[model samples]
Target: MGSNVDNALFFLVSTLFKLAIWVLILRVALQLVRADFFNPVSQLVWRLTQPVVGPLSGIVPRYRQWDLAGVLVLYVLAVLYIYAVFAILDYRVGLLPALWLGLLSLITMTLMLLTFSIFVQAILSWLGPGVNNRAGSVLWSLNEPLLSRIRRIVPMVSGIDLSPLVAILLLQVFYYLVPLHPVLR
Candidate 1:
């Protein structure tokens, strides 16, 4: 009975920690896209996450309007959360394994976000120019820099947008081929 209670508490805390990390990521992504940070949704996320990020921001400082400190703090939180969850579940995670898994999760999240943006862009284009979809706008804001660079390099083949395909392929390579820290292997 006590064990069950302990497990329940562990699960609850782990889930909340994970949710907090995701909320922080969403806040950063919103900032990246120039979303109204003061909107109810954004403000709620900021409020939930700032308690953790606020102090870290002071330590690392901001650069070029980019929140490298926030990203680093999120990464550290993710690693610590993973470690705690494993410890609570009685699983051993060596340093290398933890680092590799954390990196893998980060890469996966980034690729998923990129793929989602590409899918949104494709759908918006199909819906034609007049439809003003906010999702499309957000996707464009997130993806435009990467896609623009690709466009300059790749050019449009037969008037098709190959940038998305290229981006997906690159993401796939990172997902599968990259050798993680040796300790993980």
Candidate 2:
């Protein structure tokens, strides 16, 4: 009974922390992609993250399109989340190891976000065809830069834009190419 209760508690804590870490990551990525602030999804993400990020903004400067403060806060939160999970699980890891794992988690989360954004954007494109509604706009904001770069390089095949395909493919390749062993060791 005690072991079961402990396991349940571990799961609850870990899930909550993981969700928080994901939101923080989204806060950073949306800024990195320059997602439209007025979009409902963008506004929701900002509202969720603003409290944590607002306090750190003065300390960490923004670089061009990227919000450096948000990124830093995400990193701090990721590391803390990992540490908390380890503690809750009653598993011990050295400080350096925990930090490295946290970094690996961050990278994985970023790639996941990119892949998800691209996939959703692709679906939205297909569903609405030529519509430029707020949902489409939000998706475009998240996907446009990377897709535009891919479009430039890949070219349209017979006037059918294949940039989304290429972008998703490239993101998948990067996701699989990310090394996890280094962080684990």
Candidate 3:
């Protein structure tokens, strides 16, 4: 019973942290993609994240197009999540190991976000070729630079763009092949 209760609590906490991390990521992506600032969704994302990011912005500072503050916050949240998971599993993590895992988690999250954006762009291409919403625009902006490069190499076949397929394949390969275990071990 105790084990079950612990597991349930772990799941709840982990889910909540993941949701917060996802929001932070979306906020960063929106900025990176230059999403329409006046859009309702964009405004909501900014408002939701501004509390944490607004202060951190002064300390971490932005580097050109990258939101270093937002990225640093994500890393801190990832580290906290890792520690929480370890505690729930009855294991204790050292600071160095926790930092390493946190860095790995951030990388994994960024790659997953990229893949998701590409996936959304591919879906939008099929559903509505002319769709022009904030989300759609953000996804396209995020994916276009990568997709265009892939397209240059892969080329379209039968008038269908295969760049997204190739881009996703490469991203997936990197995601799976990344040596995450070595860092943890």
Using lDDT as the measure, the top candidate is 3
Question: What's model 2's overall lDDT?
Answer: 0.78
List pairs with backbone clashes in candidate 3: none
Model 3, range 1-185, lDDT digits (tens) per residue? 15888878877887787778878888887788786778777788789889998998988878877899998888899899889878887888999988998888767777777888789889988998887877777677667878989888997899999998999899988888765753222
- Give the poorly placed runs of model 2, Cα more than 4 Å off: 1-14, 181-185
Error of 1 at 118 (Å): 2.1
Clashing pairs in 2: none
Superposed by TM-score, candidate 1 places the C-alpha of residue 117 at a distance from the truth, in angstroms, of 2.5
TM-score versus the correct structure, for each prediction = 0.67, 0.82, 0.87
lDDT of 3 at 114: 84
Q: Which residues of candidate 1, in runs, are more than 4 Å off?
A: 1-22, 29-48, 55-59, 95-97, 128-130, 179-185
Alpha-carbon lDDT of model 3: 0.81
In order, the Cα lDDT scores of the candidates are 0.70, 0.78, 0.81
Single out the weakest 10-residue window by summed lDDT for candidate 2: 176-185
By TM-score, the best candidate is: 3
RMSD of each: 5.1, 3.3, 2.8
lDDT of 1 at 76: 81
Better of 1 and 3 by TM-score: 3
